[model samples]
Target chain A: MSSPAEYAPTARTVPTRSRERAAYDAETVHAILDDGYLCHLGFVADGLPVVLPTLYARVGGTLYLHGSTGSRPLRTASDGGLPVCVTATRVDGLVLARSGMHHSINYRSVVAHGTAHRVHDPEERRLALDALVDAVVPGRSADCRPADAKESAQTAVLRLDLAEVSAKVRTGGVNDEPEDADLPHWAGVVPVTTSVGEPVPDPGLAPGTPLPDYLRRFVGA
Target chain B: MSSPAEYAPTARTVPTRSRERAAYDAETVHAILDDGYLCHLGFVADGLPVVLPTLYARVGGTLYLHGSTGSRPLRTASDGGLPVCVTATRVDGLVLARSGMHHSINYRSVVAHGTAHRVHDPEERRLALDALVDAVVPGRSADCRPADAKESAQTAVLRLDLAEVSAKVRTGGVNDEPEDADLPHWAGVVPVTTSVGEPVPDPGLAPGTPLPDYLRRFVGA
Candidate 1:
């Protein structure tokens, strides 16, 4: 018998035994979520599973997802809460190879398993929307106009509690087999990274308008 | 009552009635999967959930996943098949904001729900590995040295059948609310994209080795 917490509604997808490397604690989960601005949300739709890549923000222990009211998924949740799985991941490096089979990638990722409820409370939705903006670019919210009643009415916000979530990571140099390690093959992390280049100002911007300093302060991936 | 096909072992993440925009057909799923080189895989581990971003290749209806044999999840799967969820996403543009909350990203993504079985059959594993390499760089695999027995032993390959899957997408210009549309805020897609810069040749390569056409044929994202 499975514990109540482990009682998967549909059992086949749940693992029976835990793998040491696959497990992660709360702190690690929070760290990955904090660093990522976008998340891939997985959910069952109709009889099929769908993934949506969208902007999100972490507030306290929950993730807030926002989208247009015209979007089917968001509208469905607006009328009532729904279950959603969200995963946030970042690629840290590329594993180069001596052989095709040995090639791999280095990455860090977080998965949240829970239900997401529509944020019916107008105030909470407003704050969550702000958080979403800030998550993409710091100090960006203040520079832009606030959402008015009609605009807010046209959007939908859903909150997924990250009560049961985990983070997993794999990094470092390529793990070439010992025998092949001695072979003269170039094997190491190629170091794939994402960096914000100098911001391109809008063509119509006033000549004196300066880019925000926060945009320059990038976090190490 | 649901159709037998819909009797999947996962809960509906979005309201069944509102999944129209969130659900995609098989062709859309394969298209999204085929176009991307990396993916975000999510799975439950140790009562928690996690996501890992890694490189992948889609072959027919199966996805070939590569990682070190020592990787926790891969290792566990090598010893025994494990249930896992995988997703691949591509970003097409960034929605810039007049306000932070309105800023968003436009993307396409595919999610799969299935168990991953380690490839024990050497020949099949080799093909899977080759497909992965070829997926990254079309002609590079043949140019690279083949993996020997020892090297193959240290690498892990898992195949996930793309049975339960769907792709969702959002694209086009920013949909600013009417009131905010008139606000003195610059709102439009920044049109972010990924493209291959000129390939820097390896310093130690033979002086006469011409860059392959495959490497030069990269189209913008």
Candidate 2:
């Protein structure tokens, strides 16, 4: 995984702080993206920076994001390739250091800089839509009906190439000063985990409709 | 809570899609922000939009984000007021609809557009840093040693007013079409939750060092 051929971080994706935590490997970047269900999408709207939370899925070296046709960001990108920044983060633990200034989070995050273009091809859009659904719960697309023509026409999918991507990860315990370490303060890491609770069946679910096997073992990132 | 004095969403902060989910009350906005300890901060650098995940705490009508003094985004803001967008999202559940196009996540998110400026006042910085630590685990700051002069000097705290903030929330079960409801596909909501596991003590902890009471009751968003 340390092979240099995996990923090449551009200047934009490189971290200006804690460079030791920055990773430029495809494996690391993909793992971080795959582990998370949501991403903060940043784009310039009317020359003002706008960040929106959206669902995303990573398929190989490309990331797919879906929204309604009326979504401002999607509509803006549909006109042409819109320069966008997408970031996915998974907080693994809360680092409680001996000092307030030293408090931090143990997290794995990936920042991607790319141009997002709306997927116009019907076949590709369908595949992207499926990927998005399956990204939430593995094998979910298989258990559900695919979008019909009218539903497909109303949705907008955007694709971003994973060209400029880097993952920054912080792990391990708190880093307290040597002097502060002897203080009576309690310092350690509180592990944070995102997990799926019991599935709530729809009120209108048909009798004897069983919960899908994929959902029973579903674990969020 | 619906009073007009609470929040006034501008054209930029208004939702262009799913307008029903958009919320313009201060209580809603603050609640969403308070529940999450992390936020995706968006700012433009050299004409390119950048989004980074960082720890944040909401104090009154202002949100404080702290980072290394050497961080690019913080340095960029310290020069002058930098237009920034901060977004926090919590995925409550995965809404699996009968059709792929209707798939969505039940989430609560707040998108705030404001200008962030570095906090230079020492007293304010201390208060903000304390709020940040306590934000992760309630009453954590009291149990931890305060930041020393040198540590505070090296850190950069940016304050963004929560004036132009709005929360968008999506809840409830799958909204499948009546026609597709009869499809054999299974549809429901898988609840997602972020929880705190048992605290991991530091390897170098001194003998008789007890786990703090705050961590025992810690509950993540």
Candidate 3:
């Protein structure tokens, strides 16, 4: 793996000492982001740190995030072009073992550092906002309504450039000790996976509207 | 809401004009941590930043995290007593709408700041290690064989004091425009929940060995 240990932001702000796993190159970082659906954003509020989990999408070298204009963080960031750190992660599987100490999970994740700038231009905001929509359901954006003036006014969109980012991943099976390997304890990966179930039709859908193929083919993250 | 808009970390992290959500006291902070099962750990590596999702458990004012000794991040941090930033999040529901632009998700999250220290004492290491095990599945440690010296040596434990932490959350109904609210568009929370299904017994388990209550009652995060 191409580790970018030297490029990660290391301030008192970030305290993890696992330098090697704490940072990675753009390729690794983008791969993790492409596979995940959500991100947790970190920023300062009143001198303390606040983390918020929100829907996000990656476009080229930047991440776009948005929420209600009424949201405190979004409202504030949108108004002042505040800097916010965002992170995305996906849990792949669960490792079960004969010993509690050896049990673990397999996962992939990305963390990025940058300032969030509000997207105010009509066209850019429209496009940026659609990234979020597309992220959850790729082709659904074209099928849905574009934000009208009033709706656009009520939403806040912030853009964070992916200038600095990294990814850390762990995979594979149990690592039982030589002596314990034959101790009659069942040890293996339980393989936890996310799968989408049958979609519930909208109670108010017009009589003959069929389910969208994109939605029907949906698979859980 | 005691919005401490002038906190230190917040001042450093948040741009001058960003609106940070309310500052949380220990009570509120701990509540979010206790309620959520997973955390996104942020750290800088190779000059870039990365985030990873992992299970976490909080006891009093401290958070305990563990991973394989071979894991690069854990190994590097254990070697230098480096501090790491950890975050946890929970999604309450998915807000679907008549229009994609108005759709959103409801969520809660917590972020903690601390310098992770490697647990060297055998007894504390064992206990701290078990805390992680129990966090994933209560009573799992007792049900399984204890980690032998070799197995214990293959794992690494990091301790983080949950002193500087904060939580930002958003919840409610969709923000549909007045014009679109009654446009015959179905709007409401679809209600996404994480729930555990039936457990599959290990193939080699003794024929009549009943499933442990913890494993059987497991709730997905």
Question: Which candidate ranks first by DockQ, i.e. highest?
Answer: 2
Give the range where candidate 1 chain B is weakest over 10 consecutive residues by summed lDDT.
Answer: B1-10
Q: Candidate 2: give the clashing pairs.
A: none
* Model 2 misplaced stretches (Cα beyond 4 Å): A1-5, A219-221, B1-5, B219-221
lDDT of 2 at B18: 84
TM-score of chain B of 1: 0.86
Q: Interface-residue RMSD per candidate?
A: 5.6, 1.1, 5.0
Residue lDDT tens for model 1, B176-208: 555555455545554444444334333333455
**Model 2 docking category:** high
Q: Compared with the true structure, what per-residue lDDT tens digits does model 3 show for residues A125-191? A: 8888778877865665765667778878987888887766666676777755455555555455545
Per-residue CA lDDT of model 2 for A57-156, tens digit only, reads 8888889997889888888888878899999999999988877767788999999898999999998888898889888888999888888888888888
RMSD of 2: 2.7
Candidate order by lDDT, highest to lowest? 2, 1, 3
Reference interface contacts recovered per candidate: 0.19, 0.88, 0.20
Ranking by DockQ: 2, 3, 1
lDDT of each: 0.64, 0.85, 0.64
Model 1: per-residue lDDT, tens digit, A82-168? 567787877765565555555665677766677677787988988898888887766667668877788788777888876666655
